[model samples]
Target: MKSILTILVFLVTFGSAFSQTGEDKHPLLTDRFIIGAGWYFPTRDIKVEVAGDIEGLEDIDFDETLGLSQGDNTFNFVFFWRFSKNKFWSVRGESFSVGSTRNVILDEEIEWEDITYPVGGEAEVSFGVALYRVFFGRVISSGQKHELGGGLGIHGLNVKASVEGEGFVGDTSAGFERSETEAFLPLPNIGFWYTWAPTDKWAFSANLDWFGIKIDNISGGLWNVSPGVTYQIIRNLGVNLNYEFMNFNADIDGTDFRGSFDLTFSGPSIRVMGNF
Candidate 1:
């Protein structure tokens, strides 16, 4: 699948390099509003450990320990709005969801909260994450074929993890044991974006965001990189091919969860865009 996407992108770039439309600028550079939707294929490495009052707990490597898939695909949506009178400012938003579930026999004893999942028990583990982001930016520099800007943004994340299986607690066996934990993290970030149009119909763009901050009882850091290409199929519609990379780590001392999570998700995405 990756090879196919690579070929597609190469073909688009090859065709656009030699083709030129009469228009002097790309439509995406001038559109007041742009909306896009697509699918995302990601490779994930997620590590988690919950620190409870009970003392002894082990860090879990989701893919290695639980047999979860390292690669998966999901739907994605993005929106852009240039709202100022002179079109020098804009706001952008994007969203996506990631999740995986697996059933495997435990190789070693695992303690989660008050329940102990013993070795040789078939356990079901599932993890899910939902991300929502919005940004406000101003174009500091621009030309007929390029635009550069930076802005402040916020990321809203809701993550949940669960384990269910036959387990034991304090020498007492529970035919069925289940433990689940969920957390909501709101992280603020700053980002920059750049776009270069080689022709009226083809453009190359990239966006980067990063931040390290402590808010309330949550200490977290985040960074994201996205580089893509766009082809204007028509005056009001286009298509996008992009590769996204994200890394986020956080520590919590709250009532819901008292542990840490370090996650990395990277993938390629293709979307359809409409302008207004």
Candidate 2:
């Protein structure tokens, strides 16, 4: 009976030592799902060209013509899932929406969709963008401190634009022209991700991804880089501080409306995640 009690004490002490040292489980290694919510600040330039009987009215610059400016600060959401036990594969998705509207007096005559507005007229221009992305990636190399990978993804884009006019000089009543375009593009990308462990309590990470393609009436490219740090407060809970820079350019042509746009968004965000 004395020998049995001694063995039980030894086993309990070993288990307690292992738990305190975290020898069997690392917080990041065991993480399977992460949901992120944050804010985005975007600066943009937009131009649209239309074709019809209207001459000299085909090209419109939202900034110079109507004083449209960059998008306002907004909230964004992201989700990630890791599917490999060895941390070799994963999938991620993100979605964001941005829009802006401006009202100004026209500096020149404008015609759209068979309607003409003379100079000294007032017009309202509104533009919006909704973006979605899904990607599958593999970790080519990984260690306790670093990871590198590459993959393919599809970016879905939806654009909505409209111009409404009032104070027309002549018989053309107050009118509006609106168009919406959507496209889903597949792109192959390469990326490198790195992690640094300053201590068992904190980890710093960064990543960069880029891709470009042109086919048919669609042509565009995308690139993003982000750096972040995570602080583990306990075994399964943590907080993240991240800075992201993103840029995308696309040209689209269709039967309804044809235009080109370039947008840049850069901002810092904070999120909380749990490892399960």
TM-score per model over all chains: 0.90, 0.74
Cα displacement (Å) at residue 7, model 1:
21
lDDT of each: 0.89, 0.68
Per-residue lDDT tens digits of candidate 2, residues 1-276?
999999999999876643334343345544678676767666656665544455555666665677876647777777777888876788878888888788878887766545665678777777777878787877776665445666766667666666776533247465444433434434455666666654455677887778787888878887888898887778777787888787777776765555566656677767776667
| TM-score for candidate 1, residues paired by index | 0.90
Clashes of each: 0, 0
Model 1 worst lDDT window (10 residues): 16-25
For residues 86-159, write the lDDT of model 1, one tens digit per residue. 99999999999999988999887778776788889899999999999999999989998899999999988888
Model 2 per-residue lDDT at 59: 62
lDDT of 2 at 67: 80
RMSD of 2: 10.5
Which candidate should be chosen as best, given lDDT against the real structure? 1
